[model samples]
Target: MQFSGFFSAAMMMIVLSPSLQSFPPAEAIRSSHLDSYIRLPSFQVSTSPDSQDDRFSFRKAFEFRNANECGFADHETTGVCDPTLVHVAITLDVQYLRGSIAAVHSILQHSLCPENVFFHFLVSETDMETLVRSTFPQLKFKVYYFDPEIVRNLISSSVRQALEQPLNYARNYLADLLEPCVRRVIYLDSDLVFVDNISKLWSTNLRSRTIGAPEYCHANFTKYFTNSFWSDDRFSGTFRGRKPCYFNTGVMVIDLVRWRRAGFTRRIE
Candidate 1:
């Protein structure tokens, strides 16, 4: 039942830019039209010189039967704009494609209203839409291409090269990538699978908070920073009067309405 360690361990292997670790606005930053900067190339597994051995293949016929409690028949007829639908966002790449598929399967299997859930997938590769549809023919999903160049300059050196990948920061720009009608969304990491109905998590109330997640106040927050950061009052003093805690970015319920209104993505850059 304890998934904290599992999530933490999995996340350690998948690195993200240090900028994404905390929330603070940079000085005089401007937002760019990410859509115009990066293009999703055609699906070519062999394009990379070393990609010949890195082909990804999944079961072409993986399907999940919905529970009777799930009133799915009507949901199929409903559009994604329908207020009744639950929106879930996840990233898809070669490294985590299998885990992402399994996570989708687990959600559908356990959800009481499987048909009401619509997925918003952030992908950097081409032909991902075709791949996802082939796996789950009945799935309600759409793919958004996240350009790596959008965050390349914002990223700093990390312990692992994987953490510095542009796709890892894609979560930081979900508000800009998804449809504006999707006011709320559950951003899930591709590495984990769920045993419970994801809709339960989707329905959580953020209240006045821009985002909500399990916070670990007991964990040492200072360890995430460096001696130089702590040594300087100008940098360390930012946490004054505020109680900071550790929260895994792997799972979160984000209020995109509040996020966009506040211009959080611009600040993060």
Candidate 2:
């Protein structure tokens, strides 16, 4: 079941970002109106022409359309902030490109509203957008470059070398990396497939929580920390009044609105 070699080898996550105050009246988010709400400087993706030497290639997937009940007709528009749109984010890297493609294909193949799903790909490498475009053909997606330097020093050695990649930490900065209008996002690891409709997962009611994911309260979470961390009451005692369960960041429903209001990016750092 392992898609790639890393801990908890097979898993999925969805994240939903909630609003801090009142939600916006309009359901649609247009790129033109972003200037008023954009708080972070936009990151750049490489525009170099696709090279023949590029290491990966994928066959074009059949275009999937929305079912009649969905009532979605905005496919002509390229807006990423559409409330009806399901925002799913995944990190893209050459090391796991195969898994990433398979995940996307599975989502599209099983989704009830395939066209309504928008992908927000986070990456440290360049020229991947081109590859994705060629493969999906009619896929709705945008690529955002995650500067490795932003999290380079913050990352430390891990049990697996793949865990050491700076892009592995890109999920922490997603609230800042995505458009301010993207309030909710499903952050997925590029290593799993969806056999059921993703909309079912998207419709999960997070209620007042910032993020939602499968919780394993029975797991020995303490083993994740170091001896010094366990010895220090300041660090260990932070969980004293709470029941923290082991949750995979890979599959999460993140409320970006709640994340931005709480300054989660800075908190994670």
Candidate 3:
């Protein structure tokens, strides 16, 4: 299904989610119960890196609840597929674990219905899961391992070596990585801190579009490519009849349903 709305920003990526609704009060919801959770199918990994030995420790965040007007909070455990839950995805690796944790904390601190938010963490390492569990004991989240080999051959040299990391491309595969039940998700970079209720942003209507983000229509989009790319119509023809705008992939509202239907992961690979 296509979402409705236009979000304008100089640099941002846009995406989608399920319809919105009022959830029950936060006081009735308890994090201790862990009965049913949707398990993510594992990706085939070709290599085994050394185990994480010195994982960072974080203080558990104060659990935030929904206001009385909010509905859908249940005494039983909330499943990942709950229509009232807001789905958000973020990549986790040793290099950005601290920032990810901080970002999660910031989101919880500012959300009107923190307990209604579900996090889908993408990771290249297996050990980060334990670390995240300890840090956010009450957090409703799941970790999905993304094999680096999936993008190893697809990467080319870049001006900054950090941009070439395999995990950096993890967002491109969200349609393939997350559960089929999860129709839409917000993909976030570790560097952002939210000052407003995320549900406000989550409530965005993408109209008939597959994604939504802050658009930078004024930037010099051509400077992102090499001279040879512009010289060949075969290489640059992809933008033939359209106006290309630069967007910051850091924050995006992605409609996974549309993304999968469009075969975006295969296209990116």
- lDDT leader: 2
After superposition, which runs of candidate 2 have C-alpha atoms over 4 Å from their true positions? Answer: 1-56, 217-245
Please give, for residues 1-269, the per-residue lDDT of candidate 1 as tens digits. 12355543432232223654453211111112221233232232322445454344445444555667765456546566777888999888765565576678777877777778899999888768877776678888989999988988888642234466688899999999998888899888776667777766777767788887655556554655667767779877887877776676777889999999999999998
**Which lDDT tens digits does candidate 3 get at residues 1-269?**
22222433212221111221142111112121111132121211112245333223455556777777777666246488788888999988755554576678878888878888999999888877766776677888989999999988888642135567899899998888888989989888875566667887787788777787665556554655667767778867977877765565777888889888989888777
Report every candidate's CA lDDT: 0.69, 0.71, 0.68
The TM-score values for the models, in the order shown, are 0.71, 0.72, 0.71
Question: What 10-residue stretch in candidate 1 is worst by lDDT?
Answer: 24-33
The global Cα lDDT (0 to 1) of model 3 is 0.68
lDDT of 2 by residue, 186-233 (tens): 988875677778887787678888888765556454655566766788
- Candidate 2, backbone clash total: 16
Q: Which ten residues in a row are the worst by lDDT in model 2?
A: 24-33
